[model samples]
Target: MTVKDLATLTPSGYPAVSLLMPTHRTPPDNQQDPIRLRNLLTETRRRLEADESVPADVAAAVYDEIAEAAAHVDLRQVGEGLALFASPGQVHVRLLETPVHERVVVADTYEIRDVVADAARRHRYWALVLSEQPTRLWSGDGSTLVEVTTHGFPFTHEGPGGTQGLPRDYGQNPSAHRDERHRQFFRDIVTGLTQVDALDTRPVFVLGVERYLAFFSAEWTAAIAGTVPGNYDHSGPHDLHRILAPHLAAYQAFEQIAALEHLDVARGANRYAAGLPEVWQLARQGRGAHLLVEEDYHSAAWIHDDHLHPAEQQPTSAPAGTLVDDAVDDVVELVARQGGDVTFVGDGSLATDGRVALILRY
Candidate 1:
């Protein structure tokens, strides 16, 4: 998805990201160092949570430092967090710990299916169901059929004279039926889409045949066009957890980016467009969670009060501003200090020209 779409998909109100790092602690060879290693982990978690913007590089550096400090400790085994991605809509949960040499073993092959089913049960919203069957019916809280169609042979056979015997009956094969079933499946989907369009929540996940996905895309593009804001995944089979995981991760990222971008845009409005008193008024009313400003006008001030008392009281060395400039800077700083996100846009860019929008009323 485009970065602009990412901004729009973010949920409006949230605080403090839930960072899940399910890792296997390798016990140090020296029995005496267990406490020390545990302390190191605790410190790492604290450091990560304390930062405002902790990028990947900063995390790596912090990890390296901690590892070096614990050199004397003999940590043998490492476990990877199987789910390391962010959620789709509201919460942006990231998996920090990476897997090492050992591969994660799923005791039962059907375990993935069970996980997906459980998630569907928990969140009854837009459940994107996926499957490998033709004309298979999914009857969950909000279920839809997905007919996967692939143009490939299911199996191969050999003839008596060292010649390959091709299956002449295409319609009888499960794969061949997928296409036909999928075409029929869209009728049900379009009905659901009509109902879903009127609702306020996100659309349910539907995983199924490749043909189903193709039909869904075309229908959505033609039917809703610019109205739908969120991104969806139609890839792979519907084993509850696997299908839902990536969407969940993406949802989480969208929210985080939205909150941050919104704050930036609000800050921009307060600074560069001081003539627009409505912008500052919105900020005061807590409606200014996000702001969009031109990237070139990064130096604009965010003023809050109409009077220039703050700038006037500054010493001679401080930068002087006209009454207008002071008023703008006051609003910009006010928004920034109050935890709003501001996004700087380049000139002629969508964001600079009002194409880059924010969700204030949501």
Candidate 2:
């Protein structure tokens, strides 16, 4: 399933169970996935039964839904990881390439923002390869590129040639004439893209040789601003992936820089928050406009009465009843449920010891 599918889920005021775990894409790993899933379901059942506050009927309903979800897991459809969400009368399982830590969360809402952000990073853009021959279009995440057909394109390159109903041949000034044609060609491409139902709001990255790229860049539209200067016209999908890595990396870096700029602006305006405690408070109150968490940062913590109790280390002496998992995961979920944005950034992006920061809506 897509991230959009995950985002549209509305809480039903009933218990929502979220299960995330590493699953196998291939054998050995794949072989053990069923066992892992079974184990998770067992844990989920135990948690539901142990929660004395949950109504028996509601707990049973949720558990049965979880079982139904587990029953449909096709090994062939599994990916490197798996995420399952279950609530009364609803269940969704998404296969993902990014591995998530093994965790089970039972709450009133689903913890899905991290997965949504991951999906965006991997598969949010369309790659348009501009060529004199067959102009190609691809839907891609950072890791994979799937070619998509654009009907009636490579317009001039195809049908007719020469003057009358034929391709034009600029005599001596072929270079200048061709340049102007390319300019107009790119303009038309921009217009076409705007009307394309498939393109939507996803960013477009144009790939072509230096000359064509220069021409396209001059007439660049906001819809298609990213241009990669290269010649990969004959490359297949695998080769295209390799070609795209550097460009995608550069794009993500640019996004990170922009996020930092926004954070700086928010801080200057006194509309920002830092560290876990403050960010958590804002998140609980739905005051978070944007949450920026350091990538690979996780703290064991749990919420009680809307307060975040964070533990720096797995304390030798712990509270009797505390839900300690990745606190950042809860932060992401809270921001997402409030319709706020969440961004996972590089280690030092926040420049704070807490490794969590927020841009407040107020």
The candidate that wins on lDDT is 2
lDDT of each: 0.36, 0.72
lDDT of 1 by residue, 200-269 (tens): 2343444544544665666554322111222323332345444455664455345445644554665565
Query: Which regions in candidate 2 have their CA more than 4 angstroms from the true location?
Result: 1-5, 10-20, 25-27, 34-79, 84-93, 101-114, 120-123, 149-157, 161-188, 195-200, 223-225, 312-324
* Reference-based TM-score, model 2: 0.70
**Tens digits of per-residue lDDT for model 2, 1-362:** 33444555765756788998888778766888888889999999999888887888888998898788778878666566788888877877766776788889999888786577456335467777887666777777556566765644444443232122333455546556555666766777656655553535576778888877776667764655367788878888778777777777777777778888899999889999898877878888989888888877777775555566667433344444356566776677677767787667788777663788899999
Candidate 1 — what's its lDDT?
0.36
- Estimated TM-score for each candidate: 0.29, 0.70
How many pairs collide in each candidate, listed in order? 59, 7
Say which candidate scores most in TM-score.
2
